[model samples]
Target: MIKTRVVVGVDGSAGSAAAVRWAAEEARMRQAELRVLIARHRRESFALDARQADADADTSTVQTAVQQARAVAPGVSVRGVALPGYAVPVLVHAAEEAALVVLGSHGGRSFFGQAHGSVCSQVATQAQCCVVVVRGGEVPADGPIVVGVNDDPDASTIIGRAFEEAAMRGAPLIAVTVRDGGSSTAEEALGTEIDLQLDPWREKYPQVRATREVIGGKPDKVLLQQCRQAQLVVAGARQQGALLGPVGTRLLQRAECPVLIARA
Candidate 1:
């Protein structure tokens, strides 16, 4: 089992319910514990509802969600939490002790693109571990786990984590590399290099079958395509693109499945 664990944000919404389910399965497959985090709405503290009432409500909802997760993921150790702070800061604090932080793509009531949803965006950008965004599906067996790789120094880490996840879940690893090879000769050169990188992965995790493909066009198109059938898609935060919206402005928001951006 991984030394740390996965913490998922929950807010008693359908999307968060999906997040709870996804995080539970991932933790189960990894033999890691699942932490169901319910960030106490700071503003709620001053609401018409008394502190005891809101706390009780939040705690009860978290308990129910944890029970549901236990039912869905039989053997996974599930834990509940109703934290007393804003979502992002509390999550970042939790991340200080987790291997992965999982969340729903869209928050409990906000669009994924909200400029004010600092918790989700901040956790995605600043978390020290892998941050997974479960966007579209909740069915456990929907599709394969996709990984985006390049010559970036973090590529190997991405490969290892993706392979580990795929192997545990008995899912295929869709290893994808986006190439901006300007011409036919350039394409061949980059494609060969891509092959070399993937070659080592085949031997490293022989049980997890992998397929490599090149996106000769723009980077975003290639990534989006790879994630179309992905149950989980992972990307490394390019040092250069750290300010380019975590996973990238478009890819982060448009991915069809959960997008895990690895940051160590």
Candidate 2:
């Protein structure tokens, strides 16, 4: 039976392994199935390459990733599928029915090098649902969940997703607002507006402990500092241009914990 699952991309990279672990844990917490996906491009097709040895190897890689995910979350329902297509389109289609999509910060890269923009970024940007980029960090059992909000309409979507995530993990939610440069009066006013915007979430998720902070600084830097103690950091993506917002891209590169980008 087809079920809603936390879909994760696995390509035998260290980063992909880390993503598998995080996705498995998240699936367990959310009481959802875990689906591990690996995409093989047309050029990598088994019939065309090395008389099926390459296909066998690719299949083994997917199965090994499935095993690792199962090890991470024992008893959680996990399945692996190997698809024939490019990474971006394959993963984006997989997200159609997924509760959320999780990807590693970098995939199939030897060194932990530049990943400011990669397949993960593209998939996250194009996916219809939420996308999580799992980076290096030990998510503490009791760490708070951090979310960055703005004055844009997309902030509502971001904050709502953050509340749901915090409730699922039973962790406190920290709502951070970064202003470029505002006077104390303007800051106070913006803080009040933000609080008003959070009312719906508060009522919907009364069990979640929510706190708000507004300060003048660069959004990316401020959120990175908050990530120092957070289990997860969430940011909003514009509905129009770009798959990921500027701030979300930065956090994916530098966050100590996993970063979730909620599409508006």
The 0-to-1 C-alpha lDDT of every candidate, in the order given, reads: 0.75, 0.82
Listed in order, each prediction's TM-score against the native is 0.87, 0.90
Highest TM-score against the true fold, candidate? 2
Which candidate achieves the best lDDT against the true structure?
Answer: 2
Question: What is the per-residue lDDT of model 2 for residues 177-217, given as tens digits with 9 covering 90 to 100?
Answer: 88889789999998998899888999999999999999778
- TM-score of candidate 2 on Cα atoms, chains taken together: 0.90
Task: Give the alpha carbon lDDT tens digit for every residue of 19-50 in model 1.
Answer: 78888878887778989988765455376667
**Model 1 — TM-score against the truth?**
0.87
lDDT of 1 at 135: 78
Worst 10 residues of 1 by lDDT: 107-116
Least well predicted 10-residue stretch by lDDT in candidate 2: 107-116
